[model samples]
Target chain A: MKNRNIPKKLQDNLITIGIVVVCYILVMILSATGLLSNLLQGLLVPLCAYIILAVSLNLTVGILGELSLGHAGFMCVGAFTSAFFSKCMENTITFAPVRFFLALLIGGLCAALIGFLIGMPVLRLKGDYLAIVTLAFGEIIKNIMNVLFIGRDSHGFHFSMKDSLSLGLEEGGDVIINGAQGITGTPKDSNFTIGVILIVLTLLIVLNLINSRDGRAIMSIRDNLIASESIGIHITKYKLMAFTISAALAGIAGVLYSHNLNSLMATPKNFGYNMSIMILVFVVLGGIGNIRGSVIAAVILTLLPELLRGLNDYRMLIYSIVLIVMMLYNWAPNMIALRKKAANRFGRKKEVA
Target chain B: MALLEVKNLSISFGGLRAVDDFNVSIEKGQLYGLIGPNGAGKTTVFNLLTGVYQPDEGFIHLDGEDITRLKTIEINQAGIARTFQNIRLFKELSVLDNVKVGLHNKYHYSTVEGLLRLPRYFQMEKKMDERAMELLKVFDLDGEADYLASNLPYGKQRKLEIARALATDPKLLLLDEPAAGMNPNETKELMETIRFVRDHFDMTILLIEHDMKLVAGICEELTVLNFGKILTQGKTSDVLHDPEVITAYLGE
Candidate 1:
């Protein structure tokens, strides 16, 4: 059984990695052959970013069995912090890629720090209360970012609550952030290759955690908190571990996203309840805890609107219809039976082949 | 010294004493039964002992160490493990993974090692898997190791819960209504399993059971409670036959 488990685990991982590599190669080929339009190529980086967000959000929502609606808040933290860092380094650093990597690290760490602080109190609450608290947190973050102002000069980076001009910077100093205006002039260093790498890295961290001992402890807590505690599992420790890691991965995705845009703002529409809900939609519309399902769902949903531009007025309606049908097909009881039968038939055919 | 000792343990909720002044002591390798009527606070006592509820007034010593104020997981780390009144197996996890969760605390690999798939991680995981399989085999559940725990039959689920608890390698095991909802034959098998666990694992066990036959067949000592207070406690036969115990059982 142990030997069988090894190969099975390896095969599952191989399949996931293989899919990612194939998609990466296909995108590269399309770009090289001039077959992929600039508009479609522009969607690639954001698609990868959304895929990472969906997968990380699934870690907390699906595997951890905790309803969190503040994933966009973590991404917002990462995006703004990393954007600010890149803005500061723009004049100093000649190499865009090096600066981008550092920004990703800083972004992920900033988000993780916030996740740890929030998870400590928020995770203690369960069910709907947890969701509400996280939602409030997301709103709070967005509001704070809206009012935030910072500037950098020879006197060093100055922070002010009033506004960007109130930071009282020296001549030739840059206004890194203006209230409601957000950080501008951020290095647009993110490319399809970088996005793909980040996506693979996100998958690696999340999938690996799902298979580890700590991961088991986390799922056990989700299954039954009392039973988990009886076995000496520290509920808070593992919860925070999953939550913080999920936040960090979302942060990495945010770094990818913000760096791709020349100007990024922490507006309500950009990083508030609607964006959070959109990410949750990706997780749920995906198969909840499934990593590969998340990637597929994110890619399909993100590309669908662009691919169906001919029906511009009805694209969202069509997408909504597809979503409903897919949910019913996946979750309806009779459909589950049919899916199982189809799977068995496919397995049998593969065996014969 | 006794392996587990409880003195003046009490807990209340909303001004009602759920478990009042409960006390017991069990030596190593002992099998003690806690039996009572409905709402008699039998499960509450198990909760207090296992740190699910902090006793308002009491001292609980395990292996001669005071563990009265420890948290649930801390108490478990101190070598105390428990099953639930309702089976609380990791329902979506595989039967093998359910047991492996119990072995989680025993693994020494760091999270970084696990994330990187280091040699130490694989080594420890392989060892834990083999041990988990062995534990399943003991419950005759080796064949169902890969099945979801929720899919198991009632009797097998019960066995798996106990198997999971044992994987914690506890010095004192607590079972809250292990025989609840079982047929007479299933109850009888549980009795044998309870005794087998005590002798085979060399651990002290305290169980709450409503099945009188099971209590009589396996338990050497018994504590009977009524309304959160101890009614009678002594050797199983003596307590089970006590006039007050009979009255309590019959509600006469």
Candidate 2:
């Protein structure tokens, strides 16, 4: 068979990439035909952002086997840093694409740096303790962003934790970040096409990492810490690597998110523990460690509420039901056995044909 | 010089001395056995030697270098590898990947190379696959390379663990209770595998086993531990026949 030529891991990765590509093509056709709704069109960029968030979180939760509740905190860090960079360089960088691209890099790197710093001490705690600490960190980041104010004038950029007036500016100083209001007038540079490209890049990075030697080391640490150490896999190094990379990817998603909206604020609804839990919901429902599943789940879940707008009150009821069903489908022992048997039967039938 | 040497290795848990003033010397390519009663500190010695537990008062020399204070990964890099008393395979990973993880330090490619799928990544991965498969074939686990480690039958899991340990290319291989849960038929087969490993890999093995038949059948030297101290140490046959050892095991 032609399929036998490619390695199984490669084939799986290609299928994931193919799924994103196919979806993009379908969306493009829909929009070209003018059949796409306004609401759905607006949801596209955020949908891509959520997919990236879900996949990146899977690296920490599913692959590294660490429970982190501060994912949105990293996302918050990325959004603010990248948004701040883009705002400051908006007139200087002139070109929109170049500015957004640099913002993405800044966002990802900033998140990664923060992730490494936090991971140094936080990763030392496992299970519930790690989750709680991350949760606190997320809240702390969001709270800090709330009180923070920054302005620019003749004396370079001024930073203040108090108020905008405290940032003693020279002549005509532009208030870049007003406390609680966040950065405004950010160029709406994010689009559906760029989001899809980022999703593909994220998938490529995650899937390739999972199959590589470093990926093996990370997964081995997850599987058996003692055995991994005994076999010469550095435990702390792999854990931090996975955590930092995961945070960086989340930051990229944050960059996409920040640029999509005119005003990007670190609100509880957007950058709090609730937001982290929502992304985690996508990862868990999609099947932990299953990259393709995360993509599909993010798309379906993001679109579900909008698609079910007519139901109004019953929309969330149906969403919760779907969550339960998906959990059972992915994790329930009996369901798993049934799935295997069904797959085997189908395989045998195909062979017979 | 011996391939592995230890002097006054000891560790205590709270008020309890888990292992006390332990010492051993194993020449290259020799099969050494450690035996003792149920609570005897056999596995603790393996832990100390492998750097799972740093000795409270002693030193370990592997291949003529002091690895006494090295961490577990450093100890493995310094040429000591071990299997757990209970099989500790990467249960979620493929059998091949389990072995590949052991080949981690032996092969090299930057993380960026791995993520970007660079030329070096492909070259090293191909080498890793071949080496991992060769190790699996040694344990006759080549056919099940894609099988999850947890899916393997118990005896094969044991063999896979040994294969994984050997993949690190360690100078000293420590197998803790290799025949703990094996049937006699499987144990007989394992004894042959162990012997083959010693001859083929030129490995120096230190194993803890309750199965006297497997030990007596293959071990060249033996140590008997009782109540955190060595009761006897000598040839396998002589240690097994020692009266004090018999009393420690059977009770007078």
Candidate 3:
């Protein structure tokens, strides 16, 4: 009853944050007590990255009601840009935290810029068309990154689409990005703590925006475009705003991703259509427009494969089954009714107590 | 001056003239009705007035300013708000948020301020909530303010749409078939609500409806359209009794 004093929205946001904090605390305690396996420990930062990606993508797919299949492209933009910056500033900055923080900003801003430019014409297209276009853009970004080359020496930085040798540099020139090979020796400034902090920040921005005036406008457009227009909600502006912010947050995830790896590469397995679909799976299985659901789903789905590694040959088979079950649980009509019934009964019990 | 003035407004789709040379002048605080048979371009006229469809020719003047060239959002900002023939509530949003969306322009805060939870965001949101609740109370929907808009009963959804439109503080309001699917009892209540809205808000209303009972009960003036042309315009009782209007509605 005391909880009634807080707004329902604020209370929901608090519970989501609370779930994250509780999980973080549990993980910390286990790691400190030597109960956590190294393999699980290694998954922590990446888990944070996926959570951020899922939440950010939800901003577009769930809340904004746009299907985008090019999320990995934004992530690639963030990863490469931040990786490039960190490598160049490694010797000069001499401070890991400050350098990493700046890289995060650079990564997010670059992704946002790309998102804005792409959203300008692309947002005009709705439904399946937008999805296809975004999918193509994702591949284009990954391919472009594959053939990109940059080298730095005394005379600024040299760039080329060809091999590293084409980047005509003077003596002692360092190749930061060497086409296909990608960037290496980037300072590993990302950690579990940073990842958790970024997740919290992402949640804060997204949840607050959803509860704000702008969020209402965006949601209105999603619910009914023509009605939203008649009510005077600027369609293009809100669409682009949500798209850009979603892209920027994805970029932050990318920064975390690249920094976690010893070497960053734009490969088909990593920053391609597959990666984009994987993030989308997280969003869908989580429940579209359900923010906390995205976090939980991302965690479970990401950990499932790793947890089932001992199952080996049957691993994927079980994974797909889990995917199907989760889909039904979240979206199937019968399951929805059952869930409602169960919730009602549970509420009655609580009241009786 | 008329609150809404339309002069020779027209539009065509492909080969068909959906609405041709439509003309109407509604004085301040008057309850006006636009009635027509199916495919008579009644809703199309509503669209033109609300900027859902740009007139092929002619002008629309609201209060003294021309708004014919304005975009949909601009038209709303110029103080015209409308509800759709189909209940187009934001189904996923709560009833309160649906109205809050209507109050969006009246309340202002930058995206940055909202994201950062600045004091201005809090102040503006508080003001919006109070205003939205007051609007909801007018329709007796305050009790279900937190329910999803789609969860409301059919009659209540129609009322919610009207309440949402009013949140814009519009000089003119347009309702398209507000009683289309309602039972007679609901229509009777709707007529009372429409009359109350006019008297309480001192508002000008232009509604497109097929419900003759609701129309005759609340509307002060009536315009009947047939084949994209105005068949007649006069006081509610006279228009309903006019032979030409009767023929247009019932066929010769």
TM-score of each: 0.94, 0.96, 0.96
What TM-score does candidate 2 get on C-alpha atoms? 0.96
Model 3 stretches astray by more than 4 angstroms: A1-6, A311-353
* Whole-model alpha-carbon lDDT for candidate 3: 0.92
Worst 10-residue lDDT window for candidate 2 chain B reads B46-55
- Number of colliding residue pairs in each model: 0, 0, 0
List per-model TM-scores for chain B: 0.98, 0.98, 0.98
Q: lDDT of candidate 2 vs native?
A: 0.91
Clashing pairs in 3: none
Per-residue lDDT tens digits for candidate 3, residues B26-133, read: 999999999988999998898888887888899999999999979999999999999999999999888989999999999899999999999998899899989999
Quote the TM-score that chain A achieves in each candidate: 0.91, 0.92, 0.93
A323-348: candidate 1 lDDT, tens digit per residue:
68878998899999999899989888
Error of 3 at A11 (Å): 1.3
Off by over 4 Å in 1: A1-6, A310-353
lDDT of 2 by residue, B1-252 (tens): 999889998899999999998999999999999999988999889888877887889999988899997888889988988988889999989888999999999999999998888999989989999998899899999988888889899999999999999999998899999998899999999999999999999899999999989988999999999989988899988888998988888888
Judging by lDDT against the true structure, name the best candidate: 3
Q: Comparing 1 and 3 by lDDT, which wins? A: 3
> DockQ, per-model, please?
0.56, 0.60, 0.61
Error of 2 at B95 (Å): 0.8
Q: How much of the real interface does each model capture, measured as fnat?
A: 0.73, 0.80, 0.76
Model 1 alpha-carbon miss at residue B204, Å: 1.3
